[model samples]
Target: MEAFRNAVRMVINRSSDDQQLDCVLMASVQKQLTEVADAVTSVWPLAALSDLERRECAKTSAVRRFPTRSIVYDDDRNSNEANAYFVLEGRCTCMQRLRVRKMTTNGRNRFALIRDHDGHGQSHNLDTQKNVQTVYVKMSDLRPGSVFGLGERRSGRVVIATADVKCLLVPLSFLSKHNGSNIWGRTVCSLDGTNPTIEQSFRKFVVENRWEEYKKSLANDLFRKRRP
Candidate 1:
């Protein structure tokens, strides 16, 4: 909870593009989130929000199209204003491929795997000895109704459009702007899982798979300092 709170603080501390044409409807979105913030935690990628909430999200979000094989976000690089997404049409493929450079040592090879919020599997390799090995993480196919990127580290990572894709994106600033009430964060967490069991299972999968690096990416992204 403290981590989440800190993330909210980081987001709130950033500047917003209120003058953008896309922000015209943000007022309505703010109001809706304010009304329902207490009842939720994480926003579920599937069907967790109410009709009204969904409608408001749609109102505030902008529809964007990307060509096939286009990069959505890069790992460790600063992401754009938008922090969340709801796929409206088409598909996205997030692939985490490993490139091992041969080193001249006899140590050992250690690897850490991270599955990102968009369902992409990521593996970070650390070698004590100079060795060369190619590792491939699982592939994630994101389709319509998939919600992702909220509160996650997206900078320097690559998310590509597998096909022509359309998505409704909600800017991170919107959530930060209303986080003072604390309801906004709750709403987000509430949707990550409908029940504790499911949430636990999801968490277990991440932990057992040693996705701590992936989790840190999100934490670092959310808490890092930014210039206004």
Candidate 2:
């Protein structure tokens, strides 16, 4: 890391001193950029690209860090800023208000409906009754090798760091349907869907967000607001 800092300092000096590129300074900058490319390769499909290709990707990407409790992404507030994140360190919680319906279900093995007196029957064959109560729930935890935000945009989802976090921020264009590989093969899930790696990284998010605790309190919370 110090080498990267020194390389920048050297550039500053050369710009002011009108000095030429020396062998040592040139090597330092090249090495740092190469290291950055290695980190970019951790995301899928990019690894399959040639060295020059991924390095170009690295050039456009950035490393971002957030402190615990900081908002990493909020769809409502950050609509203009969109990208997929590759986790490098720590954890985050993803939250959203989702409508969840509690339903009472009853279905027997009988496929035929009861007929009327003149052999006339009901138009519908299924005999299921409906009783559902709707409520909202939200939240998650993210970890290393996990990715998010691609398929989650405009979803009212908010990602907050649960611990100090570090991530590789890659542009959405790399895997988007309009701009990327799915243009032909249509095999990969773009930002419109969660990546497999994101599934692994945030597997424990539901538990971390405490769904039961929220469910227990939701009714009381709504009553309090509605009564007034």
Candidate 3:
């Protein structure tokens, strides 16, 4: 119980604040930790870690809270090589940015939205407006234990809080240093067994990288949808 409270304090990031990590809240904090662990069990990748490793990960991590619609990561500048996030509370959304040109067709006033896949491609002499609009498309809705932030699978992508969110910032360095098979390795956790049913396949879908056929998968969730 004390270990987990220290973990929370480490992430709370109020080094200057005097709010004590007192014994007074022991009962409440212990109950919360138990609930958080239950959520992590369903988050398979994190689940691969032994219970002790998972707790250690939190104790060494940084925790941050983001209010609704705040940006958690911006593909261009937000992540370092090992930077990743594990949702401990609430949810988030991954969005990808696209730039499109409005093309004037057949010298008439009709306009069409044309994708600029190459960024330099022309529309067969059609007049392309200099003012290209930037749009963000929803890639996925992330819940607890959902790990993200190692740059974008899609260029110009970002993760944003769909609701107020609290995430434990993990380096994901454990992938190369600790328990479980390499993410790319075909070896399976004996624990996953013959059949897998986690978060009704939402987590599996993300882990399998199947959402809209995205070739990349997030590591896993860390806890339940809500936390104290």
Candidate 4:
């Protein structure tokens, strides 16, 4: 056990400074794994785990390889036998069919009969029960650290490999049993859905630098809308 822990530490030490983020992520995972000796290591799919831990985990889990465009999950389906996947390599996109509803006006005051159907006979409200929309969200470009699985509600999101991909697949039942030691929620759930990664930082930087121009354009558009 000590040897395995040392091995993990060695890998962290060998990482270059440029890999600081990866190092931190690895260390954090290791720390969480220490709480449960027999539990599978909490390393991300791409991170290194001790040979012993890896082997033990594989006895119940699998490191599967997938071709490009493979479907990982389907939307709105019961995930009775679904597996949770941790991306070790390649990229995938999550597709979801969403229903959207919005109240719209045609610059008139009388309630439109084609609108609210709540038996109020009101004309201002419109029945929007059939407004369905589709949304496609890439899984952080198949980022190595992302976790999407049946247990994590991936059953409602369709995941498709955008590139040749490899992932660690674990049974949802096993994950549920060890849910206490699982850092999957803490690590992946904390992302704020904003701010690009380092590779995409330049785009965000450019946008920030041109904030004034964006503000002016927005203000001009709002002013135009308010004009008679």
Highest lDDT among the candidates is held by which one? Answer: 2
User: Order of all candidates by TM-score, from best down to worst?
Assistant: 3, 2, 4, 1
Flag clash pairs in model 4. Answer: 111-123, 111-124, 112-123, 112-124, 115-125, 115-126, 116-125, 116-126
Supply candidate 1's per-residue lDDT for 98: 43
Which parts of model 2 are misplaced by more than 4 Å?
1-35, 97-137, 177-228
In the range 96-191, model 4's lDDT, one tens digit per residue, is: 422234233563212111212236754432243443233232334555656666344342356778888777777766555545545545544554
**Tens digit of lDDT per residue, candidate 2, span 9-83?**
998987866545456677877776666677787756667767777776788777778999998887667777656
For each candidate, what TM-score against the reference?
A: 0.40, 0.50, 0.50, 0.44
The predictions' CA RMSDs to the true structure, in order, are: 21.1, 15.7, 17.7, 18.2
Model 1, residue 183: C-alpha shift (Å): 9.5
Candidate 2 residue pairs that clash: 141-205, 150-191, 151-191
Candidate 4 weakest ten by summed lDDT: 108-117
Poorly placed runs, candidate 4 (over 4 Å): 1-53, 101-139, 153-155, 176-182, 191-228
Report the candidate with higher lDDT, 2 versus 3.
Answer: 2
What's model 1's overall lDDT?
A: 0.53
Tens digits of per-residue lDDT, candidate 3, 70-188, equal 98878667634465677888889876654544345454222224443436665333245575565555666888856665332434667899899987665656544664445513223
Candidate 1: Cα lDDT at 170: 71
